[model samples]
Target: MNMDTKSLLIDTSTILFQQKGYKSVGLNEILKACNVTKGALYHHFPNGKEELLITCLHSLNEVIITDIEAIFSRHLSTKEATISMIDTLIHQFEKDGTITGYTFSSIVSEMATMSEPVRNACGALYENIQNIYCKKLQADGFSNESATSIALFMTASIEGAMMLCLTQKSADPLKTIASLLPNLLNSLQ
Candidate 1:
């Protein structure tokens, strides 16, 4: 088939999987939503749903890493970059009214245990995100050890905040984290 057909399948499947957990969304729904025949889907993804989900996760990982790197590039300090990234997230969460299916939490919660390949994709996504923060911190004069530790802490903190924001239906959690990051990072330095 063409690029558009393949993209339509991936894009539609990603949204369905994100909005509903992996177990909740069926391949038929994706096919129906995209108006593509099952034959077409199987042609693009021989392994079916598992392969599609893994591909979606990998694509999301690349997009997220690139966006995070861009955010870091625009800031001079790790604190600024961290806060800016969180702020951007908060804005998106507020605008979207619910977390988009793009986050690792959505995919991880549903399929991480059921599929090894998908779990590995989620793990890589988390690791790449953390590495972005680590590299930024290192550039701001933090040592390798400290940067790694801080990156882990920052990622966990922000991810947790995002979950809270989703459950609470407000961005208060993220805003609070953003407000406090400056003092917290300052103390680290």
Candidate 2:
């Protein structure tokens, strides 16, 4: 496949993976969406859906990991950096009304159990997030355990807020969650 086809495949696959999930989404569907033949797909991704998905997951990892690192560079301290990262995540959910299925976390929960590679991919994302927050917490003089717990809470709260926002058809849950985060952070201290 050519560069343009590869790009289209990735883009279509990302959206499809977001909406239908990795298992449920079909290769033919992606091909039809991109108006490309199966041969074309295999030309670019010989391993089929799994290969394309790994590529997509890598894309997500690149985007978010870079974003987190950039955020870290800007904040005054680790604590502030972690908080900023949380805020940025919240803003994304709020902007989209916390719609389900598009997030990497949601995708991981659906996929990580079934596929070893996907599981490792999911684990990598979690590890990166945990490390980022943990570093910040340590920098802010927080105990390692407390920081880990807060990171857990932060993940749960964000996913819960997304679910609620999708259910309620508004970003209100996210808005409320955003307001609640500082208090939760304080509680960690």
The true-versus-predicted C-alpha distance at residue 69 of model 2, in Å, is 2.8
lDDT of 1 by residue, 1-189 (tens): 455888888888887887787889988899899998999999999999889999988888888888888889999998988888887888788788877622778655755356778878888988998998899889989899999999899888888988899889999999999998889888997
The backbone clash count of each candidate, in order, is 0, 0
Badly placed stretches (over 4 Å) of model 1 are 1-3
Candidate maximizing lDDT: 1
lDDT of 1: 0.84
TM-score of 2: 0.78
Query: For candidate 1, which ten residues in a row score worst on lDDT?
Result: 101-110
Residue 157, candidate 2: alpha-carbon lDDT: 71
